[model samples]
Target: MKFVNVRNAVALALAAAFMFGATGCAGETERIESVQIPGVWTGAGGGRVEFGDDGRFELSGIPSDAVVFSFIDPPPKGEKVSGQGTWSVKRKGSIVGLIYDSTGSFAEGGEAGTLGVADGGDSPKLYFSTSSDREYGYEIHKSG
Candidate 1:
């Protein structure tokens, strides 16, 4: 009778653990799905980035005061740059990185940046930082 009781207790514990584990996994999946980038995001200084489900992206409304340091003799300051390119997302641990490829006149290169999500009521804000060292980057809000 003692052996049977112990076996039943162990089985019940295992079943409870499995149920909780499955629930936790489902919640994680919902979080990841919520973070999917497939909408128009507007940022400060009139900056905007639209990410399509088809992997195409459009960036525009960059402030002229923004600066971009290059290998040229004199680093050119950022202008009201706009471009169309392809984008891809990579997940490194818990961080989501966005890889952008520009094919516009402003520049013809790629940049990798980290994405951030804000917890502001119903509309969650999305932010993009070009450089990790910079104090201020782009703060974007989803338009739709």
Candidate 2:
């Protein structure tokens, strides 16, 4: 029947919308000095980084210069990666980013890293660069 077909179409539309919105990435967020940016951020694939309130950080399962997520590229194989070090937030013009100086698994050719932060929503947003050109990155939501 015509009514049945229309109802099915409406249902499909709602389902699609729900799936799209379920990603949980905030559309607009800005993390500044005044905003709290210290928390545990879990990667979509596998890994967690803790930004401490005392300008320190501890990482688990995070590889050096990790380009995480199967959607981007295949993750590195072998032993699980871990690291610990200091971190700070720096502002350059309108952009505010988190800079890390770490050791452990992140020591080998991966001493320094930067992550763009955007907070102030229900969750925070962190843009992780996966390439050298800075053309591609992953936008991950804050887990806590």
Candidate 3:
């Protein structure tokens, strides 16, 4: 009777661990899938970004004050500064490459350090960290 009880307890422990591990992995995958980019995103301060399925993007209402420290000569600021370019996702959707149009910041090209879904919202909020230090970024909401 004692041996049978010990074996049952061990089996239960293993089963619990397996279940927990499987659930954890599934949750991570779901989180990644939630960050879909092919849509219009509007930010808090009137900023907007549109990502199309053809790898093209357009932006308006981006703040002029947002500066990238990595650039030797950052783009100039103006009341109406819009950007258009192509974008690509890599590293299993963790990294984003932004190739801006000729008239905007990083006209050559730039990479967003991280991409993820914002917390505590029923609607999906996409967050992109523009700087490696994460000092500058955008939090935009998906449009219906």
Which candidate has the highest lDDT of all? 3
lDDT of 2 by residue, 51-80 (tens): 778877776765435433211223356545
Per-residue lDDT tens digits for candidate 1, residues 26-108, read: 33321223336678988777888888888777878855343222211212355565666565443322223343344543343
- lDDT to native, each model: 0.48, 0.49, 0.53
Give candidate 2's error at residue 88 in angstroms.
1.3
**Candidate 3: deviation at residue 50, Å?**
0.8
Give the lDDT of residue 5 in candidate 2: 46
Sort by lDDT, top down from the best: 3, 2, 1
Better of 2 and 3 by TM-score: 3
Q: Please give the lDDT score at residue 60 for candidate 3.
A: 83
lDDT of 2 at 131: 49
How far residue 104's Cα lies from its native spot in candidate 3, in Å, is 3.8
Each prediction's total of clashing residue pairs, residues at least 3 apart in sequence or on different chains, is 0, 1, 0
TM-score rank, highest first?
A: 3, 2, 1
Model 1 CA deviation exceeding 4 Å by range: 1-35, 64-75, 92-96, 109-114, 118-122, 130-136
Candidate with more favorable, higher TM-score: 1 or 2:
2
Residues 1-144, model 3: lDDT tens digits: 676445434533443343334333434422333246788988877888898988888888876554222332554665534777776664354334455545565443432223344432457665554443442256677889
